[model samples]
Target: MKEFNNKELEIVKYIKEYLPFREKHIISTRELSIEIAEKYNIDTEKTSIAALCHDLGKRYKDDEMRKIIFDNDNIEYPKHITGALLHARVSSIIAEKEFNITDKEILNAIESHTVGHANMSMLEKIIYAADYLEPTRKLETAERIREKIFIDFDKAFLEVVLESITFVLSKNQYLSDKTIELYNSLVVN
Candidate 1:
């Protein structure tokens, strides 16, 4: 097991408390996130913390998530925000309010992990890719993206966002405008 500082340990403990069943997934995400961060010369500690807390709001009910989203004036709810997408925003809020995570990059990564934004920072891109390509996913597409990450990160990110959009559409879920913006931004640039 990797050693965590006091704050990281506390976040891990909170994750265990709130999302006990997702421990393996969280660990895998943290490890992959750290690897990507190290490769890109980003902050591994921040990546680790964001990955650990990325799903913190998953345990909340849809109504609870809505309440949190509406109550926090700082959160700007997307036009087509649905229950599936609410967790990302709520997780960022929890990370900020409950965990005292004040870093904008970390918070944005957590918020955009599920549905990416128009212009993602390297940190956000890493978390989004790591969350989807974590070892436990067992999807061949994930493996392909994982392989692509080292060779061409932007291409990998574009593929991940495309995959996410396809998945949501296949499920007949409400696709957020932000995701479309992300796709357009990547393809247009």
Candidate 2:
């Protein structure tokens, strides 16, 4: 196993520390992410970093996510998103500026996973799809989506986006305009 940089190493430590059941599984989440990357023939390092850092923005307590979006270069992130929706955008921004994540695929996959984009790259589709269908995820829709992920990634992505929108609507929450637009574009294209 290749050793990680200080920061990457810290990330590994944090995942092991924070995520539940990581130790019980034969493959660490980081290793599983890399394996998923390899299976899809994507860049292993980029996927590894993106997968590890996907939840970085969830560190926020007491509107910290809102504060970062506010402080960023006039990015104008809407305050409507609460709960898990906030992490996707914040992690993308943080990774781009702070963690030196230059791969557009990695950044975009992180940004859009919570509400996927239209016409995503294969790598983006893989990460978004993998995160949703990963064995640990236990949402009501997990089994339904897993088949699409294995049988058809594009269809799986569409289903993921639609499902997210449906879930948000169920909770009476606002769906990001980006999400709506992406959904429409995907349906149209």
Q: Give the alpha-carbon lDDT of every model.
A: 0.88, 0.68
Number of backbone-clashing residue pairs for each candidate, in the order shown: 0, 0
lDDT string for model 2 (1-189, tens) is: 445767677666655765434432212334545655675677887777777677667656538777787787555555566747777778788777766778887888788777776667776666676666566656768667765565665677788777777878998988777788778877785
Query: Model 1: runs farther than 4 Å from truth?
Result: 74-80
Residue runs of model 2 more than 4 Å from their true location after superposition = 1-7, 15-36
lDDT score of model 2?
A: 0.68
Each prediction's TM-score versus the true structure: 0.93, 0.77
Clashing residue pairs in candidate 2, if any?
Answer: none
What count of clashes does model 2 give?
0
Q: How many residue-pair clashes does candidate 1 contain?
A: 0
